[model samples]
Target chain A: MSFAHFSELLEHIRARRSPRRLAVVAADDPHALEAVLDAVRDGVVEPILIGDAAAIAILLRRLGERPDRFRIEDVADPTAAARRAVALVHVGEVDLLMKGRLETATLMHVVVDRSSRLRTARVMSHLAVLEIPTYHKLLAITDVALNLAPDVEQKHQITLNAVEALAAMGVVRPKVAVMAAAEELNPKHLDSLDAAELKRRSLAGDLPGCLVEGPISYDLAIDREAVTLKRYASPVAGDADLLVVPGLTAGNLLVKALMFSAGAKFAGLVLGAKVPVVMTSRSSTALDKQMSIVLAAAATRELVHG
Target chain B: MSFAHFSELLEHIRARRSPRRLAVVAADDPHALEAVLDAVRDGVVEPILIGDAAAIAILLRRLGERPDRFRIEDVADPTAAARRAVALVHVGEVDLLMKGRLETATLMHVVVDRSSRLRTARVMSHLAVLEIPTYHKLLAITDVALNLAPDVEQKHQITLNAVEALAAMGVVRPKVAVMAAAEELNPKHLDSLDAAELKRRSLAGDLPGCLVEGPISYDLAIDREAVTLKRYASPVAGDADLLVVPGLTAGNLLVKALMFSAGAKFAGLVLGAKVPVVMTSRSSTALDKQMSIVLAAAATRELVHG
Candidate 1:
């Protein structure tokens, strides 16, 4: 019941009994609208577009779509549009929230605001699912975009956020590799020490629904050939479903290297909120955006049901 | 005058008027001997093999080489071999050092010992040169295997060490990218702050022989398309000769990713000593080890002549 590719996630969302509602803040972006239209045509999600109505309509026309075919709300300013989108999620009108052509900080600022009902006690973290050509299945990495220099406690929350997201994708009991420079515990390496603590917590059943091992290196974590060559033994050695990085920098560099250099396609979303938030980079491909929406819809089912 | 590939580095070393003498500490490993023999056949280096004479002879014969063809010194233990290797360099008997069948910490311990004359006032750093298929030229990363969690002062030394190594490879003024998670200067990210300070110091003429740009992400640092897409302005944006990573973890993960996933070929050496030290990984390919020897030989010229 695990997703081997992003297209599988799309198929899972489409198989749902009804389409989930998605609130895309600042939806005037042509690239974002194109992804939305593809999802709409596939019946992945019902869109509630919140942005400049005139721009969205003109862009829709450019795509040869009727302006009145979908729901569009006009909010001129970016901040106001984000607030309106957050409000939609607060009242249970929208199952998911998305950021389109808007500053991620702008949307995140309102999503985490204390006054906003969307704010939960859980810490918000970003989860990215990558389809690497060399890997056997989809790989998930957490806090690549959010939570800079997260502490041990924050890392615990981030690990749980990614674990839950993976579970929602039908990956039961995912194997998580808490990565570091080396496998040994060195006092000078903060990441290694943090990884040891996280592994301890997971072993104690504190972080449930995942098998955690660390401080493992990247080669030992993913490459079976390396595991055999190095004689390193672990259940998660060559089959890690999730990689919980030490900080934002390592995760950011790892994912970008995978995409630009290693030929990987990825979809990312903000987890631990009341609803899954799709806040992809503007430089992301249209297929990436479409996959993010699909992933959000699938994760939303887990949030609403549980 | 610049090396765009590892084969070019090999040719540069082969073209040297005199082959640099390299002291191979604990040289009994078959893989290490295979690489050393390749370098010897190409007249890149004259190796002083220091290890168990019986084992070295057997390995040489296994490779179809005559035992009397090269100099072989018998040392039973790893620590003693490392000390003997350092003493050879201290007395100017050897121009470079190479590690074989010995722990890097053991060799580095003797290299940095105060009593060892090979020790200098400069900080020791590990520099790795990767010939990434997607990159334009040879990419150098600093402190990948050494200097864990270096402070601002130590980072300055590491940067200078890498710059000097590049200069030895005939890059007169190398472009160095001080990589971080993002380009913006955020207070929460310590690496970004350190990158900013390093950039400021480099501009103020503190770090000469290199143009330093910092607080940059991986995408903007190495990818020209990403640099143009984001419009990040810097002379080193897409054409970095050296990348000074924040710590050993980030650099280690990055190079390992490029090798395992991106099909990159790499060579590495330990810089900031009296002699260039080749301490490649045991799992490294024969070509990687050969390139390391070539790089060490090319870099030894600068150390000896400067």
Candidate 2:
């Protein structure tokens, strides 16, 4: 029952009893192919690769894998490939969605179309599970890649989005630390006010599903020594389960820095959608793509796709 | 002369023929005292430690140091101690200023008092020189520890503040990349627009003291390979001397993550308040504090403090 590694989470997914299918939108990307291949090898989920058939075959060969062994939907147009993948999920052909070599917006656009069954009233957010070598546990940074400038209400929804996902990942009663410039509100700081408001909402159950506390700095959120020095008390202090950034820029910069400077391994996916979507960056490594698949698969099973 | 190691910077501060006297405002923190003592031992500065006499004596004794060897001013009241430190700088008792055992706002309040003679039209900001092991050279992150929610005009001031500080430290015509989530303006993302505006202002001579370019992400800002993939064209893309973040939270999180997770050696100082205020966080290592002192001393001779 103790999940020290994501591999353990994968084992949970495999013994999950009901097998889940993942629809890969624009699967022509070599990196994407490698990841799905890795997932297939690990038996995480079954894949329905949707893209140009000839291109997928060429990529599979280059990756030293057989072409005809898997289901390949032949859609030439990239946008059409994305729509087809979304349709697969809608028609119950797949239980999960993924962004492949094609544009993220293209796939996301199709996924969020109100006419499509994938539309969810919840605000979409990005959840990045980062394993920094120095940290004792994984740090979950939210809304970093999605929801550019979330207002107080949007952040409320974003918090709910992350808390639930984190809970589903077995983070019981996740300690949410809303990161701001300082640990106290200075009236002039809108972010601090927003954080304080979110904390109030969490207490009042308006932003339910987590132990939310804020107007806290990253130092207080992660470092127990700083907490002792500052004399700040919060469940998230020195042991944050999820970090709720005020805006996208802060989230993006922090995650990118971890990846670039700290050798932090990242697995991020889009939440608050009808189904969890793997929105890996175009330049993401094969490992990143593979990890995103594992994450998306796990998150989707805990969402509407469940 | 090129400054490679911190020791070289330390030696440069020592060998600079005319070392500027630094006024330490309310020096009492253990970390702060240890740092000032180290700087004094290195002979890079002539320090004027002003604080409560009893506390200072106890602090020095704790550090295996004797308090009476240098000029020590006894101002028991913490508030008055800040005032005395400012007055010392005003009356030419010291050329540079350092903060110890006081909140930044309390010290900054006196430093920018209209009657204090430390205030100017230029806005004050914090600059950090991060010596990350992964990085090939020293990285400057601006407005990281100060200036929350900076607008376009305030950001201009922040940029100017960093440029001036870096220029004083001998980075003539430093490459300044205004970092954002992405390279292009996505109308929804304000940091991108702010970066583009900053670049435009630099092009129009409204912003001087550095080669400014932006709407750039962290990868392209430091890593050369990212530049090739993103196809971004800027000298600062791969070799930025300074990274101007969008706001305080972004800067704080970026630098904190850089220091804590990435193992970056960092030195922080408050700039633009008539003098370079040597300030280090409690989490800042002793080497970081000493580095800040060396930086402050090396920069004091320039247009910064004197």
Highest DockQ: give the candidate number.
1
Best by TM-score: 1
Q: Indicate the residue-level lDDT of B257 in model 1.
A: 85
Q: Score chain A of each prediction against the true chain A by TM-score and list the results.
A: 0.96, 0.93
Candidate 1, which segments miss by more than 4 Å at Cα? A302-306, B302-306
lDDT of 2: 0.81
Residues B132-234, candidate 1: write the lDDT tens digits: 8888788998888888788988899999988887787678899899989889998888899999999999899999999999989888888999899998999
Taken in order, the candidates have interface RMSDs of 1.0, 1.6
> Cα RMSD for candidate 2?
2.5
For candidate 1, give the lDDT.
0.87
- What do the candidate models score in CA lDDT, each in turn? 0.87, 0.81
lDDT of 1 at B256: 85
Which stretches of model 2 miss by more than 4 angstroms? A1-4, A229-231, A302-306, B1-5, B61-66, B302-306
Residues A1-306 of candidate 2 have per-residue lDDT tens digits of 224456666777677655568888888888888899998878777888898889999999998888888899999898888778777766667877888877777888887788776878888888998777777777889989888879998998888888877766666778899988887788878889999999988898887668888898887888787788778877779888789998889999998899888988889998987678888887787787888888777766433434
Model 1 residue B277 lDDT score: 93
TM-score, predicted candidate 2 vs. hidden true structure: 0.93
lDDT accuracy of residue A275 in candidate 2? 73
Instruction: Report the Cα lDDT for residue B72, model 2.
Output: 80
